[model samples]
Target: MTLFRGPVQAAPAEPCNTFAVPTVIAPIEGPERVVWEPDGPLVPWQVAGADDLWVEIDHTRDLLRRFEAEGPQPDRIIDRIENAGHLVVVSGPRQSGKTTLLHKAVHSLALRLDDRMRTWSNVEQLVPAQERWTARSPQELSHVRVVALAGPRNAPAHVAWAAGRPLDVDQVHDRILRKVRETLGKPEVEDGHPPGSEDLYVAYERLSRQLIEDRTVLLILLPDFGWGGEGLTGRFYRSCRDNARCGIVFFVESRNDTGCADDLRTAFGDELGTENVTHLALGPMAEGDWRDFIDARHRAAIPGAAIRVAAEVTDGAPALLTGASVGKLRKVLYAATQHAHENRRDEVDAATLRAVGRAFEVPGPDQFRRDGASRQQTEEPRP
Candidate 1:
């Protein structure tokens, strides 16, 4: 008799990660539009709903354990984090779905951080590949926190512009401390702060640094963060740079803005440099993507009907496509399909598409520009 441990078969080659790579983002004639070149082999069904942007979003929401979201960008965002390491700075234009992207990534990282393996099946699937089988291992939990969700409508105009006020280091300290306690399930160590030390910021920096040195978690998500105000809140970010302890993700409209940029330079410093920073540029999807998306949604191809109308009206912007009432979209889809079926047409034409757009109240170019100009005029300062 012989005992031989043969190599277990390799897990099926994970589908080539074509979706994670970057592609050409071509500028459109107007509408601040940029196109995503559909060069990747990835298809809509692989990520989520085939053509229904709404369906893809709902699928991601369920996966991320999030309830309030219009759509999903987990593919883009997850890749961004993987490439950027722990500290990421994300910027895109307003209404570009930055919030959705961030939340999706956070949800994914939280699952990994809180537990190395979600299920025995996942571990069984992975361990053989790594060949690092262990018995009775201690599962470490990282404290992952979602710090802020400030967006345009709800945010205070001056959140980041506090002029020479004390940095709210105490609040940051307390927040981190609370999460740390939660992580440890109790206070595990002492002797971080000095006796009678009135400097809360100093105490916080010391404590946070210690956690980093000991290897804790590295993720904080802040939407439209106003951490640039001269105070402890800003220092908290810089301290992460100084220590390289955690990942702080900032989702903002653009890097052209001064407050967030100024804070990045101040906290991360020239020493940390761009080496530690990742700027993820998000834009509109390609026409081909929408074609695939639509085909997937209907699960059948209509010869003449494509997404030209929807793409033109929404610029293929996920924010515009998503975040709408599903009932409205369902109605649009039903009408288009019903019309095509009734007419015995092979495809959905521009007229049917336009009807869908009209039903959704998606403005045309001239109308959108007129509304924009009117708003700009109204916002103009009076002399």
Candidate 2:
């Protein structure tokens, strides 16, 4: 027994590296693999590692969908029109997605038309052409035609023409008619009619018939119509009143000034009594819609990363919800997560929210301080 137990060698201590307990280490030379635990407080290095977090978040699609759904409810508009002809004016604050909504409505209309036409036509060939037509000519009619006088620069020119300013309406009308003829692959008709004349209306009617024999639906997207003056609004209303067969005219205006609305009402006051001129005021996005948008953006940025904080920071403004970069957004979110983790919160808290907001370098009112408010009165709010 003494011989057998002569040397009870101590077992060699297992290497420290092979220990089962977790080891937190700083970055060292050579290939170092690091795994982070969600339970621990976020280290500054961890926050720094998420530098490109904002790159993952994109709320553009969500914002677009919301604007499309809320603004141009075509089915509702069509239903309303069943009883009486209605002029639905879609107005909103500048850059509030009015033009985008208009385009979405046009897209939906094209899709509906395509679905109905698929029953008869070669669906493949028709589909591509339909898509092209949606962009090229939103309003395709046999009897009437629409000329979209839009584009930031051109709209002002059209407004000037309508106001009987230095610009000539007849020339502008001829140019637009030529553009339409070219678009439809029809031979350009002579500029035979004078502006603001009965013949001008006749020529438009004839042009509409040449393109399509049925009644034509014409939609003129006159954005910032107020820029030209009160006279421009009056001229547009009169044109719509006179040209029933030429389809309806849609006037898009900014909602910043009640003056625009007043001008429009005054322009169409008489017509409003006998004809259907309706005003639609588009308000800001609903709180729920904004939250969903923020959540979507957060998921997009981080994939599986929890977005408990970014949503709180955006506060649901569509511009802010969709506009910030993913990396920046992620930094804010990571900071928020870290704050929450340290505070032993299962979810983000108000302090965490404020921290996230601060991380974004959001300026206070004083930082945005401006002088000469009276000087800014001359410039119209940007659309």
Local distance difference test, candidate 2: 0.39
**What's the CA RMSD of model 2 in angstroms?**
19.7
Candidate 2, residue 222: lDDT: 47
TM-score of 1: 0.41
- In model 2, the runs with Cα more than 4 Å from the true position are 1-88, 109-147, 151-172, 188-192, 214-218, 225-230, 244-257, 273-278, 296-383
Tens digits of lDDT, candidate 1, 328-362: 33345455545555665445565555544555654
What lDDT score belongs to each candidate, Candidate 1 first?
A: 0.36, 0.39
Using lDDT, give the best candidate's number: 2
Task: Give candidate 2's error at residue 378 in angstroms.
Answer: 10
- Which 10-residue window in model 1 sums to the lowest lDDT? 128-137
Off by over 4 Å in 1: 1-86, 103-173, 176-184, 187-216, 226-240, 243-263, 266-269, 284-289, 292-356, 359-383
